[model samples]
Target: MAHLLSVNAGRGRPADYTDAALTGIDKRPVAGPVAVAAPGGPTGTAGSGVAGDVIGDLRDHGGDDQAVYAYAREDLDLWQAELGRELSNGVFGENLTTSGLDVNGALIGERWRIGADLVLEVTSARIPCRTFAGWLAERGWVRRFTQVARPGAYLRVIEPGRIEAGDRVEVVLRPEHDVTVEVLFRALTTQAELLPRTLAAGEALNVLSAERIRRRLERMNGVPS
Candidate 1:
């Protein structure tokens, strides 16, 4: 029953919420199929993996490691009840709004075959930023989100294909690692000591995230980074 509730895309819009002067966080659900591909290169060089989905902040948002973003409808519903507000698909800037999937609990390097041919690997968890906080216009949003620790997962496109709403999502592979999206998020944000534990994820960790952990661990160990 795990499937894509909706595939969303956003256009670039002027905004002071982020330092980029523009943001593509106001994503809206899109009908029909949407092309999915790996946006190769580093963060600043690559764009969104979903065609027609604009990523205005190349400095932080898009790349092979963060080619796609997925969030669970269940989590949205949880927030909806807490905040007492209606949250639509893609409201969190996720490319795929999924149903019946434990997106935040998925292990690093977990591969999902969406629809027929599109394969996406879980890379990391989204870190709330000023843009996201501004988008919600909620006070203490970043701290609140971090405390909840249900940050959605970012994905790396392993195979290019087209996907649409209502497509089935199959977990084709899951690496043997205890470092999941929630674990990784807490390691990177709130608990610095947990960074060493994330090394067990190995190559599943994204390039930038791995380097960050490595550097921090080195400093903690009194070794030169």
Candidate 2:
């Protein structure tokens, strides 16, 4: 059955990843259960856990529509193979590392019942940024990541509750739409022509997705993004 492999959180601190910058991207696994709840603020808010998971950059990283980030263990293994390195859960700054779930193929607005009470809706695909690139210490990582386009999902808390490592991940709902995480990523980064199709994702497309679509439209209209 689909389940959480681990739950990770990190404290904010200075890092060499970005010229001695303070970043909370280096997350480590937390043992046992952690509370999962709505941030109760903006759409891109973080901090829904009891262990105080840090969001270093509030302007770009977290909010209501991105309360939690999740990545698949399968995908991490694929990266490990390509990079010839050990990649662990939360390495990509994901709060939950999952197994047996098609995270990239998950439809936008897909609802997942995690553990006993937490309900989360798939909001959008994570867009690789400079911080992620720095953390990976990878050259052209953003471009390469965009090309691969299996960006893990960001989820919005629907029903607040607690969750633990090894909790069953149950797909409780899936909206009738073809805008999966991979599809959204491609539309934002490579296939601009596919932008309009993503609107069908409805509430699943958060502020970040909307901005991407807006920029695509502006480019098509010969206007600056």
Candidate 3:
């Protein structure tokens, strides 16, 4: 069954890999229930939606649009095999480590009911960063991850509540759009030409994604962005 395999939260720690001088990318699984709520305001001001979870880079990470990050265990296993390393739940800095779910295949604006009350809407795909590459200490990690185009889904909290490991996840709704998380990731990274089609997802796309698509379309139309 599709369920949360683990709930991970991180604390700020010094890291030379990031310009912020600190990072919360080393998320570790925790026992018991964790609070989930929307961190209102801009990304720079708002923090992670999961209580006890830290967002070290407020300038580029966290916010309502990325309140929660979910990665499937299946994908992690794939990476584990390729990298020849053990990747535990939350190793990718994901808040929720999911099992038996195709997180990358989820459509933009898809709604998932996790546990009993917490509802999260898929917003966008995670764009790998310098911190992520550094965290893994893998050469050409960013490029490799982008090429795979299996970036996990970022979500917006719709209903605030407590959640814990082993909670079942149910798909409540899916928007009528072809813009899946993987497609969105590819459009934003490797395939800029696909950006125009991503607009079909409408406002469901995160602010950063929508703006990027808009700029790309404008540039294509010979308009100065």
The local distance difference test score of each candidate is: 0.92, 0.86, 0.93
Structure candidate 2, residue pairs in collision: 43-64, 43-65, 44-62, 44-63, 45-62, 45-63, 45-64
For all candidates, the clash counts are: 0, 7, 0
Candidate 3 lDDT over 1-225, as tens digits, reads 899999999999999899896799999999999999999965778989999999899987899998999999999999999999999999999999999899999999999999989999999999999999999999999999999988999999999989999999999998988899999999989898888889999988888778778888898889975
lDDT of 1 at 110: 96
TM-score of 2: 0.93
**Clashing residue pairs in candidate 1 (N, C-alpha, C atoms within 3 angstroms):** none
Clashes of 3: 0
| 217: Cα error in model 1, Å | 1.3
Q: What is the RMSD, in Å, between candidate 2 and the native fold over all Cα?
A: 1.9
In model 1, which runs have C-alpha deviations exceeding 4 angstroms?
A: none
Q: For every candidate structure, what is the RMSD over all alpha carbons to the true structure, in angstroms? A: 1.1, 1.9, 0.9
What does the lDDT read for residue 69 in candidate 2?
93
